[model samples]
Target chain A: MVSIQNLHKKFGKHTVLDGLELNIDDHGIIAVLGPNGSGKTTLIKSILGMVVPEKGSIHINGKPLKNNWEYRKEIDYLPQIANFPGNLTVIELLKMIKDLRGEAKREQELINFFGVNKFIDKKLTNLSGGMKQKVNLVLTFMFDSPLVILDEPTTGLDPVSILKLKELLHKEKASGKTILVTSHIMEFVESVSDRIVFLWEGKIYFNGSVEELKEKTNQRDFEHAIATLLTGEHV
Target chain B: MFKILKYSFFDLTRSSWSYIYFLFYLLLGIVLLFLNNDLSNAVITLMNVIIILVPLIGTIFGVMYFYNSREFTELLLAQPVKRTSIFLGQYLGVAVSLSLSLVLGLGIPFIAYGLFQSPAIWDFTMLLITGVFLTLIFSALAFNIALSSENKIKGFGYAILMWLLLAVVYDGVFLLSLVYFQEYPLDKFSLIATMLNPIDLSRILILLKLDISALLGYTGAVFKQFFGTSFGSVISLSVLVLWTILPLLNIARIVKKKDF
Candidate 1:
């Protein structure tokens, strides 16, 4: 579980997160929906302690997140970008991360599931964009952490790979893991997210089930509902 | 910390740039030794190269490494490791690897030249000590610059400008001030100015240890006139150590507050 309160963050004159609050106590897929610069990544980064909030307190499972890292042991993060150390081979990177965060024997399973074994020995820079994303997914899904934070996990993924990812997310959810996802694909968001937390202007605009969102917006289609939300038409 | 250090060290070692840097130093050392007949003069020449070149290399490598390893850094940042350890480990990785390349590159030729057997061993050791100190100091400064500036171009620009200021422009300004204030006794001014910059401190330290007063230009001459050899060496070494520590501490402080 995660809890956030009164978060305030500003970039120069632009305010990204202001007086925002969020809490998640469910073990299921949650999609963080927002327009550009809506503080979606900022929120995730703050929870991970990668970003320092100007004024806020984040608590992970009852403990303060400030100056605390032990909680991260239960959280696995998949960054938005698939950038990696180009000089490192996929295997070396996988091995290095495994070494850093205790041993994970399921790496091979994830590697094969993602079909990354073909180029596992190649340098990361040599891999294609989709391939790199696959590697990123493998790294994230390899560990069986209780919580996973994935930023734009659908980037550069093909239709087949996307289905595979969906299956993996389902597998994790079935096992009672709390997964956080952010993506622009309406179809993907509609198919996978159990709950949608819509962000507008650094504040949560909507937090409820898919049916609840459609009912609030008075829109028949899911995509049209999100469009209505972004247009500031629905409260 | 050690895990990060090991990966960073391993990553850097595989890069061809490291080998090129090592080979460049090795070539410089061998050429200097063979060309300069007098061993003491060779040591002094090595001092000059180490003074200007070490810091430049350190600054460039430090900035490059930080910006290059950004993805690697973000990956580590998300882990359960302490933030301080991440930066410190990477810092040590760069500094230690660079120092190793320096020691081995220069060491091979010098030791091959029987430098240990000659009476200039102390002078050579002083040169290497100052070399390592300069590397540690400038690299920390570079990491500090990179950590502060989010834009890579801006980070690189500031880092290189810093090297230019301390290594090249500072000397010109120091000389101009000495000339402008010729009527005044510049002993204290010159000593303090030299001590303030690690580049100047290192050069004077080696020159004083080598006892080559003639090569000790205006500022060095002023330093020699003011402090005894042992006294000046101790002070300069301590200041260099402080130089290394202060920037590193700044790095820790900045990272504690900085957003990814």
Candidate 2:
């Protein structure tokens, strides 16, 4: 479970997250949807303690996240970009992360599932965009963290891989893990996420199930409901 | 911190640049010792090179390492690791490896050249000490520059500019100021100025230790008069240590509030 209150963040003159508050205790997938620069990534990074909030406190499982790192042990983060040290081979990178985090509950299994074994010996820089993402995915899911945060997780995946990811995410959710995701693919979000939390201008615009969002916006289709939220249409 | 340091050290050791750096010093030491044919003479020549070159390498290497390891840093930032540990570990990893290259590179030739039996051993040891100190100081400063700069070009630019200012420009300005204010008492001014730049302090320290202050002109005489041989070396070395510690502390402070 993650709790945030009064989160305020700014980049120079622009305010990215302002007086934002969120509480996610649900045990299923929660999609954080927002237009570009709407603080979706900022909100996620805040909870991970990667971005220090100017004002507000975040708690993970009842412990304040300020100046704390141990709480991250229970969290697995897939960064927006899959940039890594190019010199390291894929296997070395995985082993390095595993070594740093002390243990990997299911690394070998995840590696097999993601099919990263094909280019396991190659350097990270040499891998293609989609393959690098596969490596990134393996690194995140290898550790059985209670909280899974995926930022743009579907960046370079093929359709088949994405289907596999959906299956993996559902399995994770079924095991009582809290998964937070952010992606531009509405259909993917709609299919996988149990609850959708829409953000607009640094504030939570809507936090409800898919049916609730559709009924509130008076849109028959899920995509139209989301478009209405963006178009500033009916609530 | 130690684990991060270990990985970084391994990472650098595998890099070809580290080996090239090692070999450059190795070649320099071998050529200098053999050609000079005298321990004391080689020590003095090595002093000149170490004072200037060490800081230059430290700065470039530090900045390059910080920028290059950015992905590694981002990955670590999201994990169960403290911010300070990630940075300090990388900084130390660079400093230690560079120092190793310097010590082993120069030490091999000197030791092979019958250095221990020679009277110039102390001077050689002093040269290595200052070289290591310079490496630690400038790399820490470079890490600070890279940390504060989000753009790699800007970080690299600032790092090189810092080295140029300290290594070459600082002495020129110090002398110009001394000549411009010749009528006034400039002893305190010169001493304070020398202490501010690690390169200058190192130059003065080695010159004083070598008992060659006469060759150094006004500022060296001022340093020699103010702190004598033993005291002057101690004070200069302490300042070098201070230079290293301050930047490292600044890094820790910066990381506390910085966004990844």
Candidate 3:
């Protein structure tokens, strides 16, 4: 559903994404894993057109994303940071997004699932980080978009909410929606993601199923395999 | 774009700072009218205050809002909205809200003091128009600075420096130059220099409209000779419009290539 080719990005002297290419053709959960400053968020933001790549082309659903914004209508993005206009109430924020994107389906259901109804009337500044993340999740999953991108989705989430989030991801995947997530939690990545795309030093280091990754690294567990990939040591 | 404008306007209008700004003008208008006891005199006093204060407020508020709403801006950027619309809409939102504060805050007291029936009605209107222009011009410049500088403190420092350069330093340098070239014909040169600075242009526009060129020195007379004419008025007004447009166009250009 998304194709990125020859992607090159740099922040000052630090190269983020260099000659990287990624293409996904299926509807499932794909976890983007990387160490710090691995260009994972850069890649995601590039797809969302938030970060303009120095040299690259991105196509979403067979349509070239250059100078085009209408395709974003089919995608829902959950930003890593949940900072919003501190003065706006949760409902006002929701309404504003809904107004911008047109009618949103399942908004109420997602809000109920996240149990953020009580905080709807409160300003965003008053909410705890976990509550804010819940609101972020509600905003992301409410819309009936074909693609959902979550950056650090589990940040500041309670265990119950994390379970809800995993359930929501599964439900969306079951409904044939493509979800792209970036997280450092190996257990969460191993449990939910159908395919793992590991990025190392501005390039895709590994792209395959968990079993394939284990077989390649010859490691007994997923986390060790990731460590092995990073250290380049044979077990 | 309108949707973004609507939200931004609402957001700004609700902020306490907008009310404080409005109340400041309101109190200033009432105090000025009560103290001067004449519509024309009060307008003159207001002309001095507005010329300096409007741009300062606009610059500070523009930078503050842009930096403050950054995450929110990112949220909008990821949406289906066009990039230009988001920035332009926010810019307008700040400019328009500030203009409203200047107008209504000063306006209520002036109207209360029987300003509409006075012959200075046109003068008051000119003052307001100039105030709005300054607000738009400075705010757009501030947004440009904020957009180009990622560091908030640096952006704010640059914006204030810009305001200081145009509002105060420009005049000082102009005076110095006119003194250095006292033997030469500086009328045309002074006029062009004044036109280059929005603050100076606004001061001249209001001063000429108020018909107090005699209070001004030789240069003011030269400005009066130019700005007093119909053709000169049109050119000066167009220059103000151009000042507003150029920064906005820069904003559009910068936002397109900027990495959020």
Candidate 4:
């Protein structure tokens, strides 16, 4: 339900997204895979209107996203870094977000699912990296928005939590929610994402299912296929 | 905007620095009043302190808050809120909280000393107004500097340089120019120079209102002739307003194109 055309973004002399175009119409897990500095986060932020494109247009659900904010109400974002205000308790931060976005009863359910109820009263600064990531996930999923854009959602998660996250993604996908995610873990991406959009040099290089990517790259292994895509070596 | 402002205000209110700043002014007011034993005299003392100190505190606090709240800012950016509202709300939060500290801090002691019953109430009010204006002006400028500079140390350096330039270096240069051009008619020049610096403009505004121009010598007389009138106060106050507005406008404009 998102369309981007001729998107161009630059930071100083370094061009992040140049004449790039992307479209997302499916309602399932879409893992955006790219190497470091491949404009993955830039692309996501562009859709969220956090980064202003030098020259291009973005549309959400057929409506132009130019100078618009109301469309964000339909989207929930999980930033790569869980850098919350340290002084706020977990519950206060959740309540603050709820207040900003209007009421949402799903927060309690997500909090329970994430098992962050014990850290509810503790300040965010005191939480471990994994706990902070759990809190971030709760904030992102609690809103029950139609679209969710998660940037490296699995950072600092324990194995059990990662499993829990995969299950959570499956549940959301089953509910017909369009989820956009970007991550480096090939195994996690292979297991969770139904559609893979591979990015190279700020442009989409490949878009297909896991089986199709394997057939094209001639590598049965998912991680090796991504490596082949990057290295351009015959498998 | 108000929602963001509310959260920011609440966040800042909980920070210990706000309390330290508030208590500083409160203690300063009480000590100055008890020591000077006169409302007018205490205001004069406060005028000197506020003119120099308010801008410094504003610049430091503004930069610190902007850098510290960066993660929080990014979190808010992904939300449905408008870009300008986030920056403006934070700016107002810093400025208003500081102004509150200055008012209640100084207000407590002065009112305790029966400031309202004295004829110097207007002078006291002018002092606080100038303090608030300086706080707003410098904090907006600091936020602009912080927004432009991504490096925290660099942002802090620029902010402090800004305060030093306006508070100290600007006056030094102003005095040097006055001396170098002694043979020329420099009344208009000096008045314009003073008007350009918010700190100087505030000092002149309060000094003239307190009728302490005699101690200011020749330039004071010239300033007295101009700032002593109602027209001069209106113009000076408007310029102060302009000072606060221009930086805020720059903030809005810069934030629109900024990457983060």
Best by DockQ: 2
Q: Give candidate 2 misplaced runs (Cα > 4 Å).
A: none
Tens digits of lDDT, candidate 4, A70-183 = 899999999998999999999999989888888886888998999999899999999999999999999999889989999999999999999999999999999999999999
Give a tens-digit lDDT track for model 3, residues A61-140.
Answer: 89988888999998999999988888889999999999999888898998899999988999999999999999999988
- lDDT tens digits, residue span A1-235, model 2: 7889999999999999989999998899999998899999999999999999999999889999987999999999999999998999999998888888978979889889999999999999999999999999999998999999999999999999999999999999999999999999999999999999999999999999999999999998999999999998793
Per-prediction TM-score to the true structure, in the order listed: 0.97, 0.98, 0.98, 0.98
TM-score of chain A of each: 0.98, 0.99, 0.98, 0.98
What CA RMSD would candidate 3 show? Answer: 1.3
**Higher-DockQ candidate among 2 and 4?**
2
- Estimate the lDDT of model 1: 0.92
* CA lDDT of every candidate: 0.92, 0.92, 0.91, 0.92
User: What TM-score does the first chain of candidate 1 have?
Assistant: 0.98
Which of candidates 1 and 2 reaches a greater TM-score? 2
Q: Which of the two candidates, 1 or 3, achieves a greater TM-score against the reference?
A: 3
State the RMSD for candidate 4.
1.3
In model 1, residue pairs whose N, Cα or C atoms come closer than 3 Å (at least 3 residues apart or on different chains), thus clashing, are none
